[model samples]
Target: MTTQRTITVDQARQIVFDAYTTGLPQAAAAKLLTGQATQAWVTSEYAALRRRGIPAMSGQGSLFDPAAEN
Candidate 1:
């Protein structure tokens, strides 16, 4: 059996955010980041970011770019 590495919520959010900004599909991003295409995990992280007032929309603009907000 292999040990699983634990990541903090912030780290998870960053990974998801990066994937989102890079236009990676949910399943593909999740698989690339965690070795499994768990879309639910990606969804959950997006929700969490939303709750924290972070902009996280698929195919939408990034949080750091004000011009993308339009």
Candidate 2:
């Protein structure tokens, strides 16, 4: 039998960040944090992190990066 540990959302978010710092993809981090791998939740949490000035994704559209000037 396995028992699931109860963790607050903040703790979960920190876990996600820690995973990212260790080179895990945001989706993977989200899965580890929530125990579920779903695009919807990953996307939502990624956006939340971005809103809080954290870059939760990679590439040119990264929220923490400056937008390229045209």
TM-score of 2: 0.50
lDDT of each candidate versus the true structure = 0.67, 0.61
TM-scores for all predictions: 0.50, 0.50
Candidate 2 per-residue lDDT over residues 1-70, each given as its tens digit: 9877877767766676666445567767666756534557656766676678754344335434566542
RMSD each, Å:
6.4, 8.9
Give the per-residue lDDT digits (tens) of candidate 1, residues 25-60: 677667766843257888877566668875445435
Off by over 4 Å in 1: 33-38, 47-70
**Overall local distance difference test of candidate 2:** 0.61
